[model samples]
Target chain A: MNMHKYEKWWMLFGSGTLLIFLIVVGVSAFYMGSTPPYCATTLDPENVREHDSFQELGLKQLDDNEYSLTILASAFDYDVGNPEKVIEIPKGASVSIYATTTDVIHGFEIAGTNANMMLEPGYVSTNRYTFKNAGEYTLLCNEYCGVGHHLMAATIKVVE
Target chain B: MSKVEQREQTTDPHEDVDLKGTLFGVAIVGFFILFSWFGVWALFLSR
Candidate 1:
């Protein structure tokens, strides 16, 4: 069949570009075992508090410059084991955030950072992020659950 | 088939047509895709 030489080159170029994407995704997911941003493992949502990880819903320092934060999300509020709902950490610290919903679904998003998660009934969503800048980052439940959804928010204070 | 006919069949019909603009546009699009993919991947890995 008669075809433009440019068309032939274009086809090769387009297919080559697509192949690169597939290969990278395959290596990341299969070879390297990378899953979604968070949301790994499962648990009984009804017994979230009884679980070992969720027993103390607060910050735990794993090592220098590294910490783990756990949060329990319910209707109209986030039970972060603090009355003011403010979590303070030193600047440049890496934090692994884990959250789950006790009653309904909620969204866990740290403003000015990439730690966005969805708190499901029986699944725990987690993400690791470093606090590079020292400031107050608002944590909001972007997913609408009830009338108090707008009021359901916390603060992440990265102190210098 | 004769060698002369085979050569004629393989010849590009629009060989004289200038495709510099098309090639440039394709290259730009390809580069953008690569940039976006790697950028998001790196961000995901770090976070």
Candidate 2:
């Protein structure tokens, strides 16, 4: 087949670009520890509130700069426990967040950060993230649950 | 001019294109793709 030199060059360029993209994605996801949220654990929606973690839904410090945050989503609110109105964590601290919904499916998204998960009624979703900067980040539900979906928001205060 | 000569002259078979311009356009698009892919990777790794 007769082909123009420019066309051949363009084809090579396109293939090379695609290969580079695949390589970068594979390396980042596997080697660099960049992965999607995963939680195989499940619980009854009626008994989520009775669970140990859901009973005390808030941030708890673990050993060596690690923390665990539990959140329960129901209706249009995120129950992040008491005493702390806003989710507060120190900068550069690794945080693992576990969330479950009692009413319907909701989206757990933290603005300006990579913390996002889908909260199902009967399943627990977990995501781990590190707060590298000190700022106030907004947490919102991306999925539409009800008329109060727009009001489903919370604040995350990352302090130094 | 002869009929054959005039016919050949009038038949514009191949179109001329600027090689530099074509390659420049390809390079721009390739750079954009590379930049976007790297940006996504940076965001993922930083999280």
Off by over 4 Å in 1: A1-3, A19-35, B1-47
TM-score: model 1, chain A = 0.84
lDDT of 1 by residue, B1-47 (tens): 66765344565557778987987888788789878988997876664
Evaluated against the true structure, the overall lDDT of model 2 is 0.85
C-alpha lDDT (0 to 100) for residue A74 of candidate 2: 84
lDDT for each residue of candidate 1 in A6-67, tens digit (9 for 90 to 100): 67887788898789889989997899865555677789998998998898987889998889
Two-chain DockQ for each candidate model: 0.28, 0.28
Residue A159 accuracy (lDDT) in model 2: 94
Q: Considering only chain A, what is the TM-score of each predicted structure?
A: 0.84, 0.92
Clashing pairs in 2: none
Worst 10 residues of 1 chain A by lDDT: A32-41
